[model samples]
Target chain A: MVRNYLYILTGVLFLYACGSCGNKGASGTNGLNDIPDDVVNLGIAEISEEAMQGFVDNMSSPVEMAALIKSLNVGYSNKYLAPTDKIEDYTTNFQQAFSLGVYGLDLGYLNMYNKTNTVLDYISAIKTLADAINVGQFFDFTTLKRLAQNNQNLDSLMYISVHSFNQMDNYLRKTNRSNLSVLIVTGLWLEGNYLATQVYKEAPHPALKERIGEQKIIIEKLMIFLQNFKSDKQFQNLISELSSLQEEYKNVSITIELGEPEAVEKDGMLTFIQHDKSIVNISDETVQRITQKTEDIRNKLIRK
Target chain B: MRPYIKTIFIFALFLALARPAFSQDISELTAQCAASAGDVTYLKDFPAKLDAGTPGGKPPSAKYSMLLSKNTAYRFTICTAPDSEGEAILDLYDMNILIGSTYNKATGKDYPSFDFKCQKTAVYHIFVSFKEGKAGNAVGIMSFVEKL
Candidate 1:
């Protein structure tokens, strides 16, 4: 029954994207003044408190990590991406949702490098998984494919694609489906970190190493989000496994120095300059532990 | 001869056209707003939910809480519904202290976006409300420029 409702909701949502809508004050049961019942019936994601929502809001998108990898100027490498063919093995909603996030970041990585040729493969995989979970409506495939084909407008392509995922994430949470949101976010971060670790192993850069170590802070926040659904068996398994990584992260520490913020007017906009500095300390042993544990967790997620 | 068939067909057509009247395209708003943040490498954005207003009252304000990492430069941009009657204002705050605002309330001028340079890495609030007690559809995008 839920699946049937979701299908209807997807269809209605896709068809309802032309203008502005309100979730209130319909004049009659079938009045034109009201938002369609199927849409309103798409109950908000079951967010119990503002804190959980905060966790979702506060968690960083994989785009930043992917962009950082690109900054390394090492050039694009296919080995860093989650295998595109791995999409089919993820048949369950949990698997599909998680891999959707994994691939979303992969798409970002591809987008950053002007690697337009390969972006479609990841997009195809993302569309498949998104459709399986009934959230494909948020993806504008026709427009996105068009954008992907024209590599000159990489900015437009990246914006549309990322914006679509953000909308899907919002829809899931609004419909009380934070369970899926949790998995998607986890998969995104996991793949991002996985990429970072791989890059660091190949060429040890202080910048990349510091970034990888600083993920300790993000992992703490992610753990809190997962614990929000610990009662679920899958979430429980994730928490237990990730907690080990957290324990390993405990071996690392980050220190910061305060600095003054400078505000300047540029191009008729206010641009503030932050002056704080942070130092991350990670031992060789801790790095190895993190690399091993992260790979293990990711392998389990993909059933590799 | 086919009155009922014609009625059903008309109803379906109305449904198709009427959707925009009742829907706010958050995705498009976010994308457009993000694009407007020129030259700033993209990071992430916070999508705010603006409620439909009551007959005459102001729509409830939307508050987005975020962790603005210290030493990082972030920008907040907004794009209100194309058909909106007024602009929505974005105000930045920390523990009730007014850090900055997109609209100069004193001057009655509005800006589409504003940037923040963080001296402290802590959770801050990005409050969204309509100007002059008015309300309508809008989206606010937060992006990173640099982390110092």
Candidate 2:
């Protein structure tokens, strides 16, 4: 009887574990859960608490970290939006607009994530957005789509994720303890570059290469700050896993051709060939690669 | 065992509760007063709930007194709905200019804000109301602010 009772108790515990840990249900599209909780809070903290709730004010969905930069009044020279103050408004508005423009993909990704709250959902939404791009539903912003086309599907997603992560990366590097920030940013930075490589293989864009090079500069700066966290196990493990993934995608390149390449500038919009469509069609091999990286990172973080 | 599980669980539960609670914070009132037709006023007895679902519902209506300023911009922003069935309409007038009007299907975000530049500084009367027929526990007259 004692043995039977023990068996029953063990079975109950097993059942609870299984039920609690099963594939988290379809979280819609945003995959917010995949992000570390502290990261999310910190990301939201980047946006001002007052401005955080006013999505309609911007006429666009919010990217928590990016929006936080606006709320910090980091770049604002003038306090209010009176027409009499041209220089301040021009500088502030231009900076705000530039941030908004640069964050298009990030905002879209966040919206897609909020609309659907899981990894698969986010992937699905990206695929849908890709399909929309394929069908010409996107506004023909020459430069924006041009930046997107370099990676095809996964590449753009990677870019969006990486760039968005970089916003936090920059903030963390600036405000927080250098050691902890470097460890986390380095992991995300490598992860960004790794994912970029996969998209690069599908489609190649020279401008994206330029951006990637810029990202490298940031990463190198981060590396200098890494020595402090060298002994931290979780940080070390994440960094190692991210490095491995980065190494795997090291050679992959994304190729893109702007329909009117010369007609576009960072200030302009252009027609972009679909580079990321291939993500929707990624094969088992690609799945294995991503899953391996994801699992390694998860294990490192989840372990006590 | 992770010590933070219950803490995280309770926190999550609290946020889930807070989201709905915040959305339902809007209220409709009965503050009606007499002023010129162009004047805008805050509606009294706001937060009138709208219908449950399926269109063909009336937007909530409220009369405001001396709420409209001649040369200022006024806007309405909504916060919550019981379900998906609620609808709100906002109309703006400036010295009979019929400056702006909008309608929105109730979701969790603010909506239907009307904007127009005011030409005069006199008090202007404005009207806001729900569609005559609707059903649901929707919040009405979420909030309105007029800026000069």
Q: What docking grade applies to model 1?
A: acceptable
The digit string of per-residue lDDT tens for model 2 on A133-155 reads 12111222332334444423432
TM-score of chain B of each: 0.78, 0.41
* Stretches of model 1 off by over 4 angstroms after superposition: A1-51, A150-152, A276-278, B1-19, B22-28, B41-60, B67-72, B82-86, B94-100, B104-109, B118-123, B146-148
Scored against the native two-chain complex, candidate 1 gets a DockQ of: 0.28
Candidate 2 per-residue C-alpha lDDT over B82-138 given as tens digits, one digit per residue, 9 for 90 to 100: 353435544444335443344423333323333333333233334454444444343
TM-score (all chains, Cα) for each model: 0.79, 0.23
Off by over 4 Å in 2: A1-110, A113-172, A183-228, A231-234, A250-287, A302-304, B1-148
lDDT of 1 by residue, A205-254 (tens): 77778777878877888888787777666677889999998999998988
Candidate 1 root-mean-square deviation in Å: 7.8
Q: What lDDT score goes with residue A66 in model 2?
A: 23
Error of 1 at A12 (Å): 14
For residue A87, give model 1's deviation from the true position in Å: 1.8
**Top-lDDT structure, candidate number:** 1
